[model samples]
Target: MIRLLACGALATVQDRGRLGALRWGVGTAGAMDTLALAGGNLLVGNPDDAAGIEIQVPPFEIRFEVATTFAVTGADCALMLDGVPILPWTGARARAGAVLRLARRASPQAWGARSYLCVSGGIDVPVVLGSRATQLRGAIGGHQGRSLQAGDELPLGSPDLSPPVAGTGLVPPVVALPLAVDGLPALRVLPAAEYECYRPVSRAAFWGEPWRVTPQSDRYGFRLSGPTLTPLEPLELRSHGIVPGTIQVPHGGQPIVQMCDAQPSGGYPKIGTVIEADLWRLAQAPIGARIRFIETDWDGALAARDALDGWLSAARRALSYLRARSTA
Candidate 1:
């Protein structure tokens, strides 16, 4: 078990996310940066989708009730365990009552917006709708279905006594697999159903310009400030099913990129959908940061997904070998 000593808003228990409940209109509320979560889990010897704490606002502090192994990943923050510095993405063992502190990012230029804290056993939140992720909008899962607060004591699953070799870590996915456009982080976007409705100039601008992530961005969606994407004519579409990564261009001309906690359906015009493989890059994009889009086709999107899968597979194999060598 671990107790929250200090926690900022939006920090909550999350797994891969609530899946297959969209028909009931439940949004998938999971870690904003899933690659970070998975990397932390791998360091702690947990399943790829194991539940962990997603820290959006930092200065988070927690105390281990029992001796356990853990890892912190994602944001390049100042991590301290009982006053001793711990490296991000590295696994470490904590004695009982040791306090873990995560300060704000060390650098603004760092590629991180969220961080993941994964333990050997994962957080033992009740499974709701086949997931442990907190559905904040529905108030259904996670700890009381809300953000964790000070003094919250979260239960943990049975610990994996033989954790990964201590101090071992994987290279962060951001560094391992990089994607950028003109020095700005980029996401592969496939043109959506309403792509043709936009004027030729609008399409060119969407592809050529870098969009700034506005302050209004949150778990729901990223409201982007960029070239006004005007359609050749006004468009009105019936509310239709949408998923995370759907980039909707509203009447205001600013594009809104749906995120993990976005509604199941939307009525806005979608100019493009960011491929699932690159959503993590957008998730880590800081507010006020500018990012560009790379136009892609169905085949390119599939290839990107395959590349991500290959990276995860290689990480798993490497970790397994390390564990075996340690025990030998």
Candidate 2:
């Protein structure tokens, strides 16, 4: 078990996400940086979809009740264990009563919005529906179906495999992952059903210009501030099924990209949908950061998805090989 010593209201238990429930009006709310969660899980030999703690606000701390192996991934926060510095995106062992601290990111370049903390086993949370992910809107899953608070005691699942050595770690192969631009991390978007309803200029700007994520954004949606995306005419659309990454333009012309915690359906005009492969970038993108949209075809989107899958497969194999050599 681990105890939340300092962090409260900024962290929650999450898994891959509750999928296949959207048909029943449930939104899929999970870790914003799923790749980081998956990477952290793989580091500790947990299944890719295993439950872990999702840390959004930083300067967080936790104490281990029992000695165990753990990994910290996502934002490059300056992490320390009992005052000894530890590397981000790496796994390590801690003794009983060891206090783990994650300070505010030391470098401006490393200040991502979220991070993942994975233990040797995983966060032992009851699985609601088909996932352990928290659906904040419905308030029906995760740790007590709400954000964690100070003094919260979370149970740890029993490890399925041997724990890594105290210093065992792996550097994330983020370079091999998909990105829009070199450092800007462009998100590939596919035209939605109402794509053609917008003016030609609005459509062009949507693809060509950079949009800044507004402060109004949250887990449910990102209200982007950019060139007004005016529809050719006033569009009164009926409520229809919407998924994560769905970019909807309301009457105000600001494009709001629905995220993991978004409602199952919406009535706004959707000019495009950001491909799933690049949603992590958006998740990590800090407020006021500018991001570009790369218009892509269906084939390109599928290829991108394949690329992500390939990366995950290769990463798992590499970790397995390393573990074998280490054990030998």
Candidate 3:
């Protein structure tokens, strides 16, 4: 394992995100930029579920302890390998003491939000609630429940393994985010437990009005302000399990979309939910942005879920082919 010197806005290990144990009150805490994380996983042949780093904007740097290949994706950060330009969404070889830097610029992919960097070998960190993702609010997962700071060290899990720098993208990583992602998608969700209690007017308004993002949003959730929604009965429900993208409407009638860093259980009544496929874009949303929900029936949701399954299977196959070709 190489010794890593944290130089800038580095955070702890993340992956596709923590899963399964939410029933036990665990948050699906992980990388905000799921697409970028998967890109790194594909480069290194690690399963997509492996942990990586969710980096902030530019001036991101680190020193390599051992020889290995690493990849960075997400965000349009100005990237430098030993102070030279590099490309994101690609992999490169670094010897012991080699430095990596990501500087921000104007691009669409990694813009104004979370990005991901993955080492050939995953980082070895303590697991909480069966995940390495840091849940800051819980103060449980990740590296002591905080972001990485300068001078801090991270342990690489495997050191003996080395693969030649073999990838389609440039070495240091291109300082730009992927421009196209099919645009922001309308989240489709079935009504939550209290869906029936909403007045007809409030229910219609939910699918009708355009909600703008609130500045007070974070990993906890996105607070949106729009429309005047009223519950059929003004009764409060007990706090229960809340999933990522679940829309909970409180007293103001505005909606809050719970995110990766949201609490496991919430007291507010959840009116609707976001479609899972649309979540990646939502994670990158900036403040004061507009979003709308496109209502879909249960069958449509099932079709979307199945499509994702197909895509993941194809991705796994593609990775296998890449590794096999590189070795041959």
Candidate 4:
């Protein structure tokens, strides 16, 4: 019971994500902002990885082909349901012909990052390697492995209607600690597989200098500019499995953050892996924006991930509590 009344600049389905197919040459493509997507789904009582619409630029208008409940998260797009203002990072309901209008977000244009719209039961699409996430590089997944366009009807299949599950909201915003990003825009680095091959001076400076994100960035990879990092030797290796957080430095001596839709295998040397909890912040960084990385210990990283998991669990419990109260 999902239908598209109108299509905007860029909008498609995503979830907590796709994974475990790197050996088969598939990249995990899902919501760039996992925190936001997770919150939206919990609000509607949907699974964390439920496929949801990712709305990019504004002027997005959708007409519900059927009655359904939904939620929006991430970028604060002035959202509306049948012209009634609704919360972007909150949940709501819709009926057949219900027009959901999304205006430009209130945030600075720099934060034109991806936002999510999760419908209950998720968006029905062919599952590719235990996921419906689209990976255009491998020529598979998603709605034909590309962004959604006009006249293209996305299959929502049939959704079971359920009463709204009231719940506690997601985590409150926090003031990021100083030096939380390592240095003032300095990308952190750890020893890489070929770290020794790089000149000692380059290694010393790599983690100390700041990098600028270039305009030549997309879902496949990010191009960055910084202090030249010429290796002591022309090092090359056999193609190996690549992870989304891997920073690939091509011959140009610039770092590229392999994004969600990056290739599964690569020959480029990786300086380090972006910490799991910080990868989503990459999505909000814009062209010419300075970037810095901070190395975190295993215990610290695990604690951060576990804390988020705890919050998600609390959201579900809130729903159960609300449901019981409503029944009573």
Using TM-score, give the best candidate's number. 1
Better of 2 and 4 by TM-score: 2
Clash statistics: count for each candidate? 0, 1, 15, 6
Please give the lDDT score for candidate 2: 0.85
Off by over 4 Å in 1: none
Tens-digit lDDT string for candidate 2 (1-328) = 9999888455889898898888788888988888889888988889877899988786689999999989998877889999999998787889999999987765766746888999988998899989999887768789889998888899999988776444656565455564655356689999999999999999999888889999988888999998999999999989899988999999999999998888989899899999988888798888898889999999999998888788788778877877888899
Poorest stretch of ten by lDDT in candidate 1: 104-113
Q: Write down the worst ten-residue block by lDDT for model 3.
A: 172-181
CA lDDT, every prediction? 0.91, 0.85, 0.70, 0.69
lDDT (tens digit, per residue) of candidate 4 on 169-217:
4442121211235434333334457767777787766766677889887
Better of 1 and 3 by TM-score: 1
Q: Residue 11 lDDT in model 2?
A: 87
RMSD of each: 1.1, 1.5, 3.9, 3.1
**Residue ranges of candidate 3 with Cα displaced over 4 Å:** 1-10, 20-24, 107-112, 159-165, 169-185
TM-score for all models, in order of appearance: 0.98, 0.96, 0.85, 0.86
lDDT score at residue 314, model 4, on the 0-100 scale: 72
lDDT sort, best first: 1, 2, 3, 4
Better of 2 and 3 by TM-score: 2
RMSD of 2: 1.5
